[model samples]
Target: MIIHTDRDLSLSGMETFTPKTFNIPELVGIGAKNIEEHLKLYKGYVSNSNLIINKIKEYEKDPVENVYVLGELHRRFSFEFDGMRNHEYYFESLSDGKKEINKDGELYKKIEIEWGSFENWLTQYKAIAMTRGIGWVILYHDKQTGHLLNQWIDEQHLGHLTGLSPVLCLDMWEHAYVYDYPTSEKKKYVEAFFENLNWDKVENNY
Candidate 1:
């Protein structure tokens, strides 16, 4: 078994992470109560991430004795960290209200190149969001290949593409839509997501 050292974790001596505040206005379809509750969940992830890091440092006093504990903490660290990061992407996309995608922009051109047209890409991406299970549908830009790829990330971290930058992220978890729609109506939630998306923020992410 491979044991993770502090260097392997890469969180050593790092400052604690603070939760970011989002200025989300009243959205269509999705309710204010939903955003309020979702923000609380985001804060939880941020708090847990900092808690996990501090715990790891405390446990590192005796690496040999705390090996097993350290191993589990290392595994859990990704979940909290990714949870925090994914929410940042999701909430930021909804900030400053909705704005249409720039059709002549680089991001739009890239999508057209990859999927033949923007409509085709939107159809396919919406389908990905309806994927079975509670998780997130992410549109990532793979710097290595210089291409855009849509992915389904299980929970907070599983199935994430390594080395790719996330451009758009849709939270498909129950908490994301339970307040606004029933589980069977999540497709409506998906549509609402696009309707309220700040494409400018997404394009900047590219």
Candidate 2:
């Protein structure tokens, strides 16, 4: 991976994203090894993102000859970029140890308005997390309506709701729990994730 600080400027003199370090602590069901390996995957996304950007620059030197390759690279960029971003949200929410929810926060109040109660929202979100696929479950704040919505993304770059901002993200991929929990018991992993969640981080996202 390209290990560099945020101060490391790219060729365009713009800041490129390096893999972010999370201050995660011990959790209830998720093992240290699980997180260690998961962070490695996150770094791969970061690496691939930088690699793709550089390759695009290289290919653009002959935009005529390398048109096809450049086209494909452009197509693949979102997958890597979104993968990096989504994991940041997922890991950050679990970072800095676990913090309890602020019942008076806007996120909590919004959930109550949107779903009638916090429990209702959580029940629905957890069920959405159990969706059969390798992807993510996200809680998005609909930008236009200011309403909270739950969405199941099919992959890093697919099925994203346009104009909505993600407030919370949960990785539903087997890699998120394969080492600690079996496939059939993935719900336990979800429960464990909430057990150690930093709702304060989630509130910040909100």
Candidate 3:
């Protein structure tokens, strides 16, 4: 469920996703065949929990915390992707990966140490499918320091903390869930978001 912003996802590519029956004509170009299709895809993403847990176990080689930072990433991606699909990617107004400093700009060494090798990171990045919501959790590269960091945000606002460019993002918000589950089942919805992650895509993103 944790998704790298990029990676290969032939089955879930932007080309094949269909839109819904009642969606506005303005949204036809947004992908999906229409609005109802979009909504279905959104709910389906929400109900993929086991995939989330298992994927998390697969991604963390170092094990920073038993707590899965990547799963949280997916939760955030769900929120962000839905907002964009709905043309709500911009609300209050705006928004915003890999590397380590002290390497004297050594690309190969940095890739090996900081990311467990470039190939591994690539595999880890592109595994998630569509997500829903309004907020975003992102991964970024601090261009100046050449290090990577993951951060969380509630809206488009930034600068509370400053760092590199965005490597990945996850959206989090209610509109993402209200359509699929009653407010009471928010926990259940969160639990079910692991079925369709595109690991290939995530690896590419990372």
Candidate 4:
């Protein structure tokens, strides 16, 4: 809950992850109350991620007796870790106020190359965000193929394309917009997100 401008996340070993503080100002349609609550959820993810790691280490001592518990904790770790990272990306994109996507930037060029035009890409990405589930719509840069790909991550951790780096992340979870807009009006929330996006931060991610 320390709101700072720096976007880099610190992860030291297994149990040490410091939740990032985002300097997000008042947004367009997303209210201060919503962000304040969302930041608390992000903090929970960070804390739970660390807790899972610590519990796993403790359980490792009695490997046979705690094997089942250790397995469950290991599986749970990704959910917490990805939740922490995804919120970081989502919050960071909305920081430092709204900035238009630079037409001349590398990210823009890649979007055009991949989806024919920027609008086309936006249309597809928005549609993906409307998928009926609580998850994230992400635009990722696949380093192996040297291309950008759009993905829908189910429940923060599932359905993420392996080896790809996320360039932009949109939280589609109801908790993301429920405070501001009803479920039927989530598209408005999506529009508000784009309106408040800091394209400079997103471009840096790419």
Candidate 2, residue 191: lDDT: 96
Ranking by lDDT: 1, 4, 2, 3
Please say which candidate is ahead in lDDT: 1 or 3. 1
lDDT of 3 by residue, 1-206 (tens): 33445643311222222332321222211222323454555444433333443454455444566346765855554443443332222110111111222233444355567678765543343222122334445545677887865455554443214645554444345554455667666544333322222223333344
State which candidate has the highest TM-score: 1
lDDT of 3: 0.41
* Candidate 1 structure lDDT: 0.92
Write candidate 1's Cα lDDT for 32-84 as tens digits: 99999999999999999999988987887778899999999999989999999
What pairs collide in candidate 4? none
> Cα lDDT of all candidates, in order?
0.92, 0.90, 0.41, 0.91
Deviation (Å) of 65 in candidate 3 = 55
TM-scores for every predicted model: 0.94, 0.92, 0.34, 0.93
Off by over 4 Å in 1: 1-13
Model 4's alpha-carbon lDDT is 0.91
Decide which is better by TM-score, 3 or 4: 4
What candidate 2 gets wrong by more than 4 Å, as runs, is: 1-15
Q: Across residues 105-198, which tens digit of lDDT does each residue of candidate 4 receive?
A: 9999989999999999999999999999899999999999999989999999999898999999999999998899999999999999999999
Q: Global CA lDDT of candidate 2, please?
A: 0.90
Candidate 2, residues 71-164, lDDT tens digits: the string is: 8998998899999999999999999988889998888998999999999999999999989989999999987988889999988989999999
Q: In model 2, how large is the Cα lDDT of residue 126?
A: 98
